[model samples]
Target: MPATPAWPPKSAPRLFVADVLSAGLAVRIEGNPAHYLARVMRVAPGDVVILCDDVTGEWAARVSDVGKRDVVVEIAELLRPREAVPDLWLCPALLKKDRFDLILEKATELGTARIQPLITRRCVADKLNLERARAITTEAAEQCARTALPELNEPVKLDALLAGWPEDRALFFADENGGEPAAQAFAASKGSPAAILTGPEGGFDDAERAAIRAHPQARPITLGPRILRGETAAIAALAAWMAISGDW
Candidate 1:
């Protein structure tokens, strides 16, 4: 006989829902998610769909009803518990809209525990749409098969951010002027509460740099010899950190 098909097949569409999922619970998905399932994916009754409630983790659900504007699925079984993300946070200076969006999406995929947008003297953009930002992260998480979502934070001025900096957490500053190598510094500080701070396109102003360096928790780190754009630095630094100190 042929081998049995896998539960929650790999091809099944994945989504993040607001409801706390439990076995046998009937979940009513509406709005955009419903449209995606019923119209885009063409899911019908008996179809298996992967659902994740940021709180309870991932589950296998069987489609029970489908309507023009909604899709209902009954939770079947838990696939995986919510994952424990690294304690590292990405504190990147807000760049242009598209650039910042890339940072948010990639950061979620790389598994940063939190994202704290910074407003520096040289930053071209200082505002973020939390709703749109959350949607980008949610979609990225679903695409990456992540069971938990990263904590998205509002943008704060550089001074305000530093003022409230936690004493226990290390802040790795990506300085264009140069400092300790990123890989080496990250390796030495593994398994600690940490955050990476990358500057904007124009880079941090002298006073801003001084202020950051003067912080007790700051550790200036260099990405490499070449200069990187705001978005590139944030993404590169995050990837390196994840491989060195974060869960890879």
Candidate 2:
């Protein structure tokens, strides 16, 4: 006989739902997600869709009802439990709107457990739209097939962030002036909760550098001789850390 078609198929549309999902429970999806399924994807009754709750994990669901503004999916089976992200947090200085958005999206994909935007004196943008930011990270998680969403934090001033730094967590400061090698520093902090702190385009001022250096939890590291953009430094540091930390 011919090979049996894979159940639910790999082509099924995936989404992250906010409600808790249980097997055989019908889920009513509305708002943007519902519109995407009913209008964009043209999902109809009996169509397979993958749903992740971020809390309970991922599930396979079949569309039970499709309406103009909403779609109902009946949860079928659990795919996998929520993933355990690395204990690394990304503390990047806020750049321009577009640049910061890029950092948020890429950081989520890179498996950072949390994102703490820093408001340095050199930062181009300080205020962030929490709703929009969460949406970006949510979309990124969906696109990357990530079951767990990284916690997005409000922008905190650099001074306050250092002042309240957790003693158990090491803060790796990417200093343009140079410090320990980035790779070596990451290796030393392996298996411990860590955070990478990068400066803005203008980079941290002498006072800010001194403040960070004096913080008990801060460990300065060098990204190399070449200057890097704010966004580049954040993404590069996160990628390097993930590679060594085995989150890659």
Candidate 3:
């Protein structure tokens, strides 16, 4: 006899649904997601589609019908609970649009609990479309099979961020000028709430660096000897921190 087909086959298309999914509930997917399912994936009745609500985690659903403007699915069972994300925030100075977009994507995939965009004097870009940023993060999370979404905050001035800094959280400042080794610093602060602050493409200026250093919670740490671009530094530092403090 042929081997049994896998339940909720690995080839199933996955999606993040807005509604809280439970067993036996029918959900109609509309708008862009509906279009993608109908046109791009060509999902048909009986096809398995993995759904996540960000709250209830992953669910296996079977497409019940396909209409011109919508695709309906019935939630069959809960597959996996939402993932536990580390209490790590990524606070990076804004880079160009394309570069910052990359940071948002990777940060979400890497399990960043939150993302705080900083606007500094040297920042190449100051404005960020919150909707677009969320979209980028959501897409990344879906692609990476993340059950939780990272909180994306509005872009704030460096000074404002410093002023509103939480006391309990340690701020791991990735200072290009130098300080402690990143991995060691992260390991030392393991089990505490932490945020990684990286500079813009132009890097932090003298005054900004001094202000950040003066912050009580800021602990400056160097990434490495070679200078890294703003986006590269953000991702590299987060990856290192994840290896040290996250679910790695």
Q: Using alpha carbons, what is the TM-score of model 1? A: 0.97
What is the C-alpha lDDT profile of model 3 across 104-221, one tens digit per residue? 9999989999999999999988899998899899889889888999999999999999999999999999999999999999999999999999999899999999999999999999
lDDT of 2: 0.92
Sorted by lDDT, highest first, which candidate order results?
Answer: 1, 3, 2
lDDT for each residue of candidate 1 in 48-156, tens digit (9 for 90 to 100): 9999999989999999999988999999999999998899999999999999999999999999999999988888887899999999999999999999999999999
Which candidate's lDDT is highest? 1
Q: How many clashes show up per model?
A: 0, 0, 0
RMSD of each: 1.0, 1.0, 1.0
Q: Pairing residues by index, what is the TM-score of model 3?
A: 0.97
User: Any idea what lDDT model 3 has?
Assistant: 0.94
Model 3 clashes, total count: 0
Note the Cα lDDT for every prediction shown.
Answer: 0.95, 0.92, 0.94
Runs of candidate 3 exceeding 4 Å displacement: none
RMSD in Å for candidate 2, one decimal? 1.0
Clashing residue pairs in candidate 1 (N, C-alpha, C atoms within 3 angstroms): none
Cα-based TM-score, every candidate: 0.97, 0.97, 0.97
